[model samples]
Target chain A: MHGETAPPPTGPFADPALYTEITQFYAWHMALMDEGEPDAWADAYTEDAVFEEPGRTNVLRGREAIRASITKRTAELAAAGTVMRHWMSNLAVTPQPDGTLRATYYSLAMRAPRGERPDIFAHVVCRDALVREGERWLIRHRHVGIDALEK
Target chain B: MHGETAPPPTGPFADPALYTEITQFYAWHMALMDEGEPDAWADAYTEDAVFEEPGRTNVLRGREAIRASITKRTAELAAAGTVMRHWMSNLAVTPQPDGTLRATYYSLAMRAPRGERPDIFAHVVCRDALVREGERWLIRHRHVGIDALEK
Candidate 1:
């Protein structure tokens, strides 16, 4: 119901202000994780944000729940002590008519244990996200699918 | 050397036609793969393209080599009979004074058997691309890293 603002003639895709703000959010969002802090991930989304994957029936709702999920994953991955580096690129920001923004990005994540060929795990995607809450954007909903999924 | 088309009063991060061309490139580039053509991948890049992965010296140089590399990868993965889908989203298009667009995208690629919890691959950043050949945007250089590499 927060669609009061008349939709901009052009979506955020062509707006530098909105585009840069959202892009910076992405960089900061990852930096928090890069420093091994999952709590920040929870705070990044809105209070009523929704996180969904392909198979998981339990949609992570609310900021607290979102934090819990990320924390659990972080704990498990931290045990291995493998340095995780995320390289995000090929991003497209589109503005919806409702004055919100939707974006798609390509990401390549690599993991290594101090040193190691078979160490590359890449996920490329067309992620669709809704941005709201004024200039402050939070991912309202996300649908994640892998590049190589069995049909 | 390609900075001849610099505008008189260009604002920061403002480029409509440039982004349009770039976005079109991304859309069609992904579609080419959806068509299941490996050669198309190579042709999508410049004659001198560089594909680099973290902690690896396996840089494939030139169009022919790049094509061969992609062909080998496709052939190897095809043996598993798994379907591959590349989804690119959250694109940040930055136009340089040199007439080339710098784009950053976040990506998620999933791989698995039909109706299963596919292995989730997260690519953090895929960057360093150049668009040349007039209205044709091909990846000149690509650098990719992973998020959950060890997990």
Candidate 2:
């Protein structure tokens, strides 16, 4: 293993390089989404991707659907002078035998209004299926589950 | 430089290994502090560490002093049914010529009350000097500045 994480390392997780890459990916990827760049954010996913939000009965399939959904949401937030930041913690990544990564993390969605303090909009547990192509890793599927629906 | 962090990297920051170590160190270290283990949290720092919170006029010198401070605060928080979690983002780790790491990150201090949603208690910029001992990285000096005083 690598770093100080608790582990009996297995598969791709054993490589510290993979660990660093995955963490950096989300850190960069989340900022694009939070900053209202739907095209850039959606490009991080595969062309045929599945996005699931069971609490809202929103299971959007395909990259175009994901891009369109976020574009609409970000436009509304921009008009309202609000910014959403997603904080990911306690990440656990496992490499599946089928050559995909099963990554899970606790996500905190913080909503900050212009010139105002931020609050937790939602607390979610996110699981992602990632596929590697060339040197880039793309999200093939994302399943987001909320604890205690905010709405 | 490795991973997907914004470029041009230098020194230890260019080493993906160091990046992994520093990130993992904080992720593990913060949990110990947030979980109310003052001793464990303080032990992550050097014995002669300096902790500074300029806005609060609290400049603690030495690990024992740091432990004492957190212990008191954590006790109060536990009695009042509160938990404080620090979410770090946009980390920048630079290696000084003196063989120490100059690390900086944006910290979101989230305050959670019992059975209630958490909110941002404070948004602070934290900078730390880290020294490596064998495979362990310990905090030598930490200076935290608040963007806007919450109180």
Question: What TM-scores does chain A show, candidate by candidate in order?
Answer: 0.77, 0.89
- Model 1 over residues A1-151: C-alpha lDDT tens digits? 0122422212223455555566688888877776679997677788888877665337777788888888877887689776666656556677777866677665545666665632435454547576677656787776665443223
Evaluate every candidate with DockQ and list the scores. Answer: 0.10, 0.13
The residue ranges of model 2 lying beyond 4 angstroms of the native Cα positions read A1-15, A24-86, A89-106, A110-119, A124-151, B1-13
Q: Write one digit per residue (lDDT tens) for candidate 1, span B7-33.
A: 655357536555554554665566455
Most accurate candidate by DockQ:
2
- Given candidate 2, what's the lDDT at residue B113? 62
CA displacement after TM-score superposition, residue B1 of candidate 1 (Å) = 17
What tens-digit string does per-residue lDDT give for candidate 2 at A10-90?
223324777767888999999998988989999988999999988565799999999999888889989998999988985
lDDT of each: 0.64, 0.79
Residue A35 accuracy (lDDT) in model 2:
86
TM-score, cand. 2 vs. native: 0.61
